[model samples]
Target chain A: MAQEHTVKSYDEELNQLRSMISRMGGLAEAQLTGAIEALTERNAEKAQRIIAADRSLDILEQEIESQAIQMIALRSPMADDLREIVAAIKISSTLERIADYAKNVAKRSIVLNQSEHVKPAVLIPQMVELTKVMLKDALDAYIDRDAQKTIMVWESDKGVDELYNSLFRELLTYMMENPRLITPCTHILFIAKNIERIGDHVTNLAEIVYYQVKGETLDMNRPKSDDTSFAVVPPPANT
Target chain B: MAQEHTVKSYDEELNQLRSMISRMGGLAEAQLTGAIEALTERNAEKAQRIIAADRSLDILEQEIESQAIQMIALRSPMADDLREIVAAIKISSTLERIADYAKNVAKRSIVLNQSEHVKPAVLIPQMVELTKVMLKDALDAYIDRDAQKTIMVWESDKGVDELYNSLFRELLTYMMENPRLITPCTHILFIAKNIERIGDHVTNLAEIVYYQVKGETLDMNRPKSDDTSFAVVPPPANT
Candidate 1:
């Protein structure tokens, strides 16, 4: 808890806040991995567990908010210190959202496992693996406060968006070909979209870290590769 | 800008921040309405205009962020004033997201209007109307610093969720029944989902406003009516 700062108490409080955020990040990482495992293995029980565990994330968020508010009141953090506290608040909320998305994926898994298992659930596992790696790297970068690492993590989100776009088109094609697949396909779409969005939130953390460590927005244009909004899927008439 | 407090400069800074937020909120409200009107009138030109205007929201968000950081650095705001500045930052980001969703809806509308309009865009208009009212009230509550009004706005978001759930099922059914309709229906689903999320962001604003005014989490256990995660849509097998 002791840093190269004059005020030992302020350093300790910030350290406590850091550790809390790390714990929350660890929980979020576990949930992302756990939900995907639940989906891949069709373990409804595991999915249920992940869903149940989300309450902890919510509780942790409240704790972070309380601590951050208390720190602001007591320490009167300015400039970088204020930004640091705000980052914790924002990052915790992002982690909580990531946890919620993981829960949604798990819930979808419960329903997916019960229905006809026609789709191989192929791309999603790959996406889950990729996203988990990204999530891990993003958190690690945050803790290390390595601006370059954060920038790298931020760039990697484009890969997530591209993967999501491909999966989106693939699922829609299946739905258009086989109406029976629409219900399952739609759920899968949401799950994949959830993962994609989780990637976006992780990118947000990376940006916050970048801004905190370096006093500037990462990149002005922010090359977002999300093509989902275009709504340009072909009709698949030949099918 | 003039406050009864001794810090005249601080009061003016806070006032400037508030006006910036209000301007951003106004832009967001117009975007939501413009997107819907674009859909109803089947006007692609109007949708394009809405899409172009999103850059303004993005610009405003950055200004709000810079101003907030500068204020924290200069004023060393404490307690309520700190909360007030933080509220402006959070609310502006939410407004930015709402604006983005509206742009997405407009983008989808351009594609949807290009395709067949078999579904008549039924519940969407009602949902859009409902969300617009919630957003408006949420902004009003923020300006007034009325916790009661904020809570009312927060509770009203359940209606948006209910409407979204109903719209989700309807669009899915349409996609299942008409194979050719899959493309447009999917786009509309995203648009409706976008509007639903905007409502959630507005609820977030209400929560922040309540916290700023009351210095507590508003009543806890927010009553969310969203059951989309339940995944009990009967598989739409009969369609």
Candidate 2:
């Protein structure tokens, strides 16, 4: 009976860890949406709120880490339970990073508000919308232990990268055409880049979810199409 | 006697994990240095070599992760041993990211060689040198399990960010002066950003080391001086 009680309590601990991860994911998703909204609406107040809220994710990550470590040492969970614990730890950290990207976007949005809006700023919202879908799906996969969803999220990140490339060219062109646009366009570029990176992190979350469920690494070479690094836009003919 | 044998094997396993981390850290340091050399020398072949070498770090990270998980499950390590194992996993992943940044620098170096060197490019080596010292000390702290060294490394990252801020402003000024320099200067900007990010990750390593040694999180607020996000360099008066 004592052994059975101990097993039951260990199961409860595992459940609690899952819930903590779930809560953290929810917070991160909210933060991402809030940041993008703040950027598009030029709502510095909202951005500041999102920035302040980021501390919660960090605190949650620490809690998850300490809890996971204690569970590992005390319960000696094996196989599936161990996999779930490890995944929770990694996913929590990933969520923290995603929230950090959101915070960065918020910070940049505050700076962006100081200048005239660049034309390419419109593209960021579109890119962020797609990223949000992937993040939501990745989190769902985690909660449901659905490996198939992870595979789908993994395949979809290419879309985000492709959008980023086009935005990259457009921003560069604008900066080239009007040198005055350089400062604002640069901030937009980084904000878009942050969104793109968030998509990549969501893909990582998908892989972790797949590993937790399947006990195997997601071995597929993720299609990467972010070519902005090689991009060189020539100055306008007048220049 | 049997229990003693088990303890001895566990000790060996922990030592192996530590050595694996040390080896990975060494590789990361070498890759950072090589990437910078490739940038300064404009050596496409060396850049390609550095990019190719990044795969090894990824492989090492996976190996360290699997070994750490196995030890945790099988050895049931407690307290300090457990903290070290967890730190190894986290540190190994951070090292992998540092190597990824180096690979990105190498990739950009190849593109940078295609264009005439921008004047701001000269500042990159200085930023990287500071980052390299921090990386070295952070790794040394990890291997030595010296919490004091972690504190020092944490405090020193401010210098790297200050350098990066200057480099950031200089690049923008160059890009504004010559439209043609925009392409190359953008790459330099990103390369410098990569080095600055590497410095941040090294600071993370220091925190991880401190935690691993002291069994407590480093709570001191790190000094951050990177202000590039808010900078605005106007175009030349003639423009």
Candidate 3:
């Protein structure tokens, strides 16, 4: 009876851990959504709320970390259970990072609101919207232990990178054409970069989910399309 | 006698994990140093080498993670032993991320080499130098289990952030004054941001070290002064 009780309790603990991760994923999604809305609406006040709300995600991550540690020490779970605990820790950390990126975007949006709107800023929301879907799907993959879904999210990141590449070029050209656009455009550049980074983290989540479910590493050389590093736009001929 | 052998084997496993982490840290440091050298020298070939070398760090991180997990499951390590394994996994992942940033800087440096040198590029090497010192100290703190050293590294991150802020302003001013410098300056800007982020990750390593040694969380509200998010550099008045 005691053994059965312990087994039941351990199962409950694992369930609790999953639910906590689910809650974190939901919070991160909301934060990203709020940040995007704030950017699109140029609502600094809402952005401020998103920035402050990031603390909750941070605190939750710490809690999850401790819980996983405690479970590992006491339960001494083997094989798949161990993988699940490790995945929980990694996923929570990735979600916290996602929230950090969202908070950074929120912070940048506040600064961006103070300057004249750059037209390329509109493209960021579309990129972020795609990322948001991937984030949701990645979390769903984790919840369902669906490796196929994780692979789908994994392939989706290339699309986000392609968007970021174009956005990078458009913003650079915009700043070059209008020197007055430089200040605001720089913030836009970072905001887009932050979203792109969030997409990267979401891809990381997909990898984690796949690893936990399949006990295998995803191909390290995933499709990568962000080529802004090599991009060079010559100065306008008149400049 | 069997119990004694088991204990000895577990200790050896733990020691192996520590040594692997140290090696990973050393590789990350070397990668960062090479990246900075490549940037300062505008040596595209050297930058290409650093980019390729990042793969080794990724492989090392994966090995460390699996070794740590194996130790946990096979040994069912308790208390400090478990904490050490967990710390190894987290630290290795952080080092992999540090390497990723170095590779990114290397990629940009290749692009940067093709452009006319921007004067502000000189400041980036200085910033990276400060960050490299912090990385070494943070790793030392982990190996020595020295909370004091971790605290020092934690405090030093602010210096990196300050340098980054100044660099951000200077680059903006340079780009504003000379539109021709925009492309290279943007790469320089990202290189600085990458280094600043490395400093942030070093701070994270410090916290992890402190937690591993003291079995308590550091105050999450460590000093952070990266204010570039709020910064605004208007175009030169004549522009």
Candidate 4:
């Protein structure tokens, strides 16, 4: 899939950049999964691992930025090549945020894990899994230059939001029913929100990919169904 | 302050891009201010106006992207010129996100306005104003090539986080004390969160400006003090 570049080193430099993005994407996925598993299993040690690992993402982000800037400076790439470098930088930033969200989720595990070992929030695992898939697909599409795959990844964010809303209501119900539950449930609420934001960052990747490959913006608005518009009131007592 | 460019049109193009950024900044400021007003005053119409005005920010974002791409394509800009274009793209994107956060805050106005009136969440206006200043200073720093100004903006995000945490605890205390306050307070909580996110985006602007002006990354981690890291157990009832 190598294009006939007059200078082959240009292609090699871009490949190196892509590999960095790929590494960063993989680390974000691992951090997310580790955080979710820690939550579900009440494994504080695992959560700590996720937190400890976030530093690598930070390093990778810095590397990506340097590589991208160097590429632009050395090659003076135009059009699609310029867009690709820009997309790499944007993707790394989003991945760094995703890793931060993972770290947030992991930090909550120490508290939620110590508390009466209740089950993890039901929908969070599902939400995290969806984001993992979306993140993977978004990165894959970028590497393959596949616009259709990127859009599919983009469309999945709505599902994550719907799942998040359900989790929000369910957590609120728990908090209201048992005042003691408030502490743990609030942590779960934020962990879920952090995962939801990761989905958003993943969708951002999709947008960057689509633009990088197709040289056109995604004309459709992002699908968002956050339950914020719904009243946060618990159901009436009789119900 | 025009540098001697071999091509006069390059400076003109950069200036035009700067003007678009300035206009976009103005619109974002208006949206943030209008959203804050609607939340504080319970004016659904004003909230709706802010929501409607978000389209202009979106339009400006698209325009910036197109112009940046076109400039890069036609000029094959190198070194600092390339970085400036990339930075502009990044800043516009962050501005778009800030506007979306404003829209989210405005969206909450309907419910908060409809519910029985309550005093403003004590720190939200303060947070919004701080973000507005950070955002304004960040952009001004970019225009003036003022690394010092951008760093100042970067440092201010910690204060915004402190304000957000305070608003969070106050809202939660009110909701727990009176279930009737849960509904509006929940909306206020989100509005506060939205404003907090606007602050983060403003910090993003600061990062881009610092990089663009100094040709170096800000050598510090983002300041963060989110309460989620703290134990969720309500503070011992006796202060």
Candidate 5:
């Protein structure tokens, strides 16, 4: 009966950790969306708010990381519990990076605010929405231990990439057509690139989920042209 | 006598691991230089070679990571030895990322090969050289455990960032002045951004060194705005 109670407590701690991470993920996703919105609407205050908000996420990251170390040292977990803790570490790091990228977007948006709006910012917000959805879904997959949903999020990244490529081409055309518009357009380009990277981080989270569930490595490298599906390739032959 | 023998063996392993990481760092630095040269010269074959060269670095990264893990598992090191292993893991990841950014530069060069040269690729090669020196110096600090030298490299990153900003503005102007130059100019912009990111990764390595030597956290997220001094930031007050 005592062993059963200890197991239950471990499970509860694990769940709480996951919940904390998911909350952090939601905050980061909102930051990305708000940053892009601020850029499009030329809302400097909103952009500043996003930048300031990152400090709390940074604090949360450090807190969770220490908590994880404490858990590892105290519980000495193995198997699934071990995997869960490791996943939490990786996910926290990735989310911190995502928040950093969003902060970059907001910073550039502040720079571009002084200049005229170059384009409608149509494709960027759409792309941001898609990436936000991917981020949400990936975190949900982790919380629910839904491997299939994780795979779906991984596949969704390709769509985000395609959108970014198209946006890049369009922005290039804009800069080409009007020499005066280069500064603001280039700032917009960075904003778009940051969103695309957020998508990449979401894909990374998905791969971590796959690894924890399967006890196998997943290829998180950029896709090669020869690979038809973006599915995680198995561990290399030598390994 | 047994303790002395074990110490000797541990010293040997530590020396070997340090040597390997330094060698890997040198290769990554050379790749950065080669990638930038390929961009400036618009050498498609050279760019192709740089792309191919990254595979070896990837293999080396994996080898170093596994060796570090093995050392940790076998020796159960404490204090500096443990910190050294952890730094190895972080440094290898940063080096791999630097190589990836280099490959991105090479890939952009490949696309720019067929187009007319945009702006003589002047600022970019300089930025790349500065980043290479930073990477080299950071590794030197790691091998020697020279916290002072590591701080210098960390400071140098701001110069690289300034150069990147200037290049971004220059390229933006070029694209705006000549709409026909948009395609190739955008490629150059990406190359510049990649080099700038490489510089950031090198700074990250330096930060790891600072942590390893001083056992204190450095604020890596702070914007590098005219700061030249290194002071150890205390952990959060709440913690």
Candidate 6:
């Protein structure tokens, strides 16, 4: 009866950790969306909100890390239990980084707001929307422990990279045409880079989820891994 | 006698892990240096060498990861020992990413070699050297378990960022003045960004070393954590 009670307590703690991470992930996804909205819409107030809310994510990350440590100390968890706790810790860190990148994007929006507009870039918003979707899907995958959804998030990152590269070229052309625009365009460049980085972080979380579900490493950069059986057809090559 | 044997075996395993990581770090540092040299000197063969050698770093990373897992399974280490093994795994991943950035730099170097010279940029080479030194010092700090060296490496990262930002502005001017130079200049921009990323990774490794030694999180992005005693002096404001 005592052992059963201990197992029950462990499950409760694990569930609490998962819920906390899920809440944190939700907030991070919202932050990413708000950041993109702030930039694309030039809403300084929304950007400020995104930046201000970063403190909460930091606190949650630290709290979850401490809780994981305490649970490990108390339970000496093994196998799947141990993997889940470690995954929670890693996923929390990755989510916090995504929030940080979102905050960076918001900060850049503040800088870009000071200048007259460059031609509104279509790809930036598209990239932001895709990344936000990936962040949301990755969190959902985590909450449901669905490896397939996680894999979908991983596959979507290539699209983000293509968008970033195209944006880079577009910005390069703008800077070449008008040197005076460099300051504001540079800020915009960083905004795009931060969004791209958030996509990478979401991909990192997906890889962690893959590990939690499969007890194996998934190299998102490489095509061939143990999970190759689930590989989706490559998206039409981006030029 | 059994206790003594166990202690010796534990020490041996820890030392081997340390040795493997140090060698991996050394190889990664070399790869970064070679990649930068290839770009600045326009040596395609050197770039090819860096690209070819990256596979070894990937293999080393996997070996270290598996060894760490085996250690955890066989010994069930606790406290600092457990943290050290976990740190090794995380650091190996960071190092591998740094190697990937180096490969990217090398690939860009090959592309840049095909184009006409964009006025020879000197700052990027200096930035790469600083980052390489930081990686070496950070790894030394890890192996020696020296918090002081880790702190130094962390502080040095601010200088690298300053250099990177300055180079970004300068390159922007070059591309603007000579619009025809955009292709090669963009390649150089990526090279600079990759080196800067390598610096960031080294700083991350330093922070991990600080955590392993101090058992506390140090905010790398922020100048100070809640505790002011360890607050790093902010880099002089970039103009």
The collision pairs in model 3 are none
TM-score of each model, paired residue for residue? 0.90, 0.95, 0.95, 0.87, 0.84, 0.82
How close is candidate 1 at the interface, in terms of C-alpha RMSD after superposing the true interface residues? 3.1
What proportion of the true contacts does each candidate reproduce?
A: 0.43, 0.43, 0.62, 0.20, 0.20, 0.07
Candidate 4 segments whose C-alpha is farther than 4 A from its true place: A1-8, A78-80, A116-120, B1-8, B73-79, B118-120, B220-222, B235-239
Per-residue alpha-carbon lDDT of candidate 3 for residues A62-119, written as tens digits (9 for 90 to 100): 8999898778777778888999998999999999999999999999988888898788
Q: Candidate 1 lDDT, tens digit per residue, A1-239?
A: 84586555888899999999999999999999999999989999999999999999999998997788667656667778888887888889889999999998999898888766756368898888888888888888889888888878888888888889898888888888888788788888888989998888888888888888887788766758878777567768564
Q: Kindly report which residue pairs in candidate 2 clash with one another.
A: none
Clashing pairs in 6: none
Cα displacement (Å) at residue B93, model 1: 2.5
Residue ranges of candidate 1 with Cα displaced over 4 Å: A1-8, A76-82, B1-8, B69-76, B232-239
Name the lDDT of candidate 1.
Answer: 0.85
Predict model 3's lDDT versus the native.
0.90
Query: Candidate 2: lDDT of A63?
Result: 98
lDDT of each: 0.85, 0.88, 0.90, 0.81, 0.76, 0.78
Model 5's CAPRI class is: incorrect
Task: Please state the CAPRI-style docking class of candidate 4.
Answer: acceptable
In terms of lDDT, model 2 sits at 0.88
Off by over 4 Å in 2: A1-8, B1-8
Note the chain A TM-score of all models in turn: 0.93, 0.96, 0.95, 0.92, 0.86, 0.87
- Report RMSD (Å) for each prediction in the order shown: 3.6, 3.1, 3.0, 4.3, 9.8, 7.4
TM-score of chain A of 3: 0.95
Which candidate leads the pack in DockQ? 3
For model 4, what is the C-alpha lDDT against the true structure?
0.81
Tens digits of lDDT, candidate 6, A49-159: 998999999999988976876676557677888788878878998998899988878877776777758873567899888988898888888888899999998988888
Per-candidate interface DockQ score: 0.46, 0.58, 0.66, 0.31, 0.19, 0.21
Ranking by DockQ: 3, 2, 1, 4, 6, 5
**CAPRI-style grade of the A/B interface in model 3:** medium
Report the lDDT of model 2 for residue A111: 82
Candidate 6 stretches with Cα past 4 Å from truth are A1-8, A69-76, A216-239, B1-8, B69-76, B216-239
